[model samples]
Target: MEKANSSVPKPRKTSVLSNYEISVSIAFKRDCEVFLVEFAKQKTLSYAKFANIWQLKNMSYIFADQTYVSLLKTLCEECFAILTQCIIHQKNVYMKIGALYLLYGLYYKQPIEGMVKIRVSYDEYTIIKDLMDEMAKEKYMEPLFIFAKLKADVAFNYVGCSMPRSIRFIKNTKKAFTAHTLNANFGENPLSKFEGILQDESVVKLQDTCKRYEMALKKNSSIYPNIDQFKSTIMDDLNAAHKKLFSEDHSTPSEQIETDLKILNSRQEIKLRALKSENATYRGAKQVLTAIDLE
Candidate 1:
């Protein structure tokens, strides 16, 4: 058989995420979920607003809670995966930081996700303390403020040696975080400080979360590279987390049966009473009209 035009656009690599991309997409989705819940409750944010929040410099206002915090943990793993995948793919660092930026808003709602929630060695504690002190002294020195180059350096240092050796490939992850953090203006979506006070407590919680995640990323000092395998492992963990969270097992209340019946009967009776009242008004109006005609 003839080699029927071998160059016929050999199926453009439409599927780009790979196992790594899938994981990253999931991470982005988690961040989206967090945003949707907080935004819905607050009725203040939209997708465009979220994009702007990721681009803003002064991010004191965005925040979330425990529900969002759990959601952020999933996103964080996804961020790590994206960072590693980009390195392997020789992709841009900007893409990776963009992912982190999105997480920033979600984490802002629940700072605990990025916090060093677990106990660490004295050395690790010292590192974190110093970083926080750095942030305290110069808010601009915050991880979100720095260039992607330095940000990746910080990420490597922060999670490299500290996390398990099984995930050691994370160290290879590089520059994407810094690129996106620095380059994209994604445009500023302004938020008010007085508005902050007027805002729901949930907003405060989410913003605090962003600060915590930034802190943790800064505190980490290990220079570990990203490993592709970690994506699958973490994906499994995330699935488990989701399953654990959404599994509803509570029984319905018995009082609901009687209450529902009463409500239905009362509604029907009310409608009948309303119809009778309307009939009386019409009859009274007709009698008035009849009397006027006779006169």
Candidate 2:
């Protein structure tokens, strides 16, 4: 309901175009409902067939008029509701498979000017997740994979909206770092303890060992490093440059996959200015003007 806001001004009720949309919407809804039933049984549908039901072509005179907007949302809700019922309530696996294909087509099909868009509410998606988990517990994983395209992709449609996403953070370890402090790394460091070797080796011998150790590190050592006697010398100034650049408040080098997830799952921004801009200049990718008035 929250995503139902319209930037396009409501058209005059008495206008000829507004009056025409009423009949068009009525017929469109009837045809769309019929398509669902046919597709569920047939297990297949073509774009040309569905596009005719959608009623708008890429450059059709159709735009976001009042009746058109109501129909826009209604089609999505009805299709999803029926599909959910078929998947959850229907006992026949073949019927359920047909229903799943119907949904798959709805979500992935290229509609007329992208008009036949399908969006799943948060509560609705949870039903599928619970079903998948139940199926997994019982050792039936095939049916679950059949629904992967929809279940996996529906999260992208839910994010930045009122509905919370169902799948998030494919992999996360909770290092809790940010660019402000740049804190990172987790778990024990391989080189955490630094016990200095109290060997009686001379400075010149230690320096020679340090060079040998460096070569050994890169697998370029002519012979074995043999620098255990100069352990302290090998780390003579290990933290010196790092200490000068950063503070004692530091951590081990850890990997981050969460930052990318954080960016992808970020909340949507309110675009007040975009609401009043030119059609192509704003988020009006599918916008249609109803009257002479401008935004």
Candidate 3:
């Protein structure tokens, strides 16, 4: 038999995220869910404008939250995996770059107003190297290699490690090559930012949701209030959250039910109904989304 051609690159098999990675993706997706719920509740702005509010700078609470250390620890644990999924598995460009920029920012994230910035300690710097070479094997990912190189250099610098200067990419890149991404403004994509905002898969979805809501607001200027109220009922739409409460297996408790339903008007009634629905559900946002997301 004739040998298969060696020149052609074989198709890359899709990488499956591990259970840990899946859990991370889902936990990472949690805030997005909450934003989506709130965004859908908003009858105030267009999608583009609405998305601006969700930016990390605007979300001042995250930096100040008592869980900041825990959150940073979690991101340090899974950021490599998150980057891998974004580069190899994620198809949405904005989501992909959002991951890139966010990871890049975390490397040098600065403290502000006594709230700590993102960091992986010297002991944890090795995490950045875990999947970098694997992702860099392909030529198209050269930019990613350079991105990783820059990040790794920061780690080396942080630890006061000295490195020799080296020759660079010459054979592969063309003289005409230039990064012209919208964010680049005709320059190479920095892939990192000094004071970047928080962005990720969920943010992108929330932005899409905003676009959808924006259209609805324009289409139903008067009825959008009702639409927003109806949309708020999505919390109970998750089956796992209400499994025992609504199932034949169990009976819902009355106090578990918020018996204190007070309504001053029709709007209050709608909101009260939403509050009651939320009360009946018993799962955290991460757990709810994790149960539904494909593994």
- Model 3 over residues 1-295: C-alpha lDDT tens digits? 9999999999976322233334555554444233333333333323232334344224333324434554444444344333333333333344333444444444444333332222333433443343344345533354365466555565323332211123322221112211221122212222222112224555456656766876677679676456552343332343333453344433222221122211123456787787789546544543445555766
Expressed as tens digits, the lDDT of each residue in 237-268 for candidate 2 is 74454355445534432222223223333422
Worst 10 residues of 2 by lDDT: 178-187
lDDT of candidate 1 vs native? 0.40
Q: For candidate 1, which ten residues in a row score worst on lDDT? A: 183-192
Best by TM-score: 2
Worst 10 residues of 3 by lDDT: 172-181
Top lDDT hit: 2
lDDT of 1 by residue, 1-295 (tens): 7879966877655332234435545544344333332223323323343353333322333233324444445434554444333222322323333333444433334355234222233454354355445545755333335333334433333443333454433443333433233221221122222223324576456556656765555555344334222112333454455455435522222233335445666777898998878445664465454566877
TM-score of 1: 0.23
TM-score for each model: 0.23, 0.28, 0.25
Candidate 3 TM-score to native: 0.25
Choose 1 or 2, whichever is better by lDDT. Answer: 2
Model 3 bad stretches (over 4 Å): 1-25, 31-63, 67-71, 110-149, 152-295
Candidate 1 — which residues are off by over 4 angstroms?
Answer: 1-75, 80-97, 103-109, 113-144, 148-163, 166-295
In angstroms, the error of model 3 at 58 is 3.5
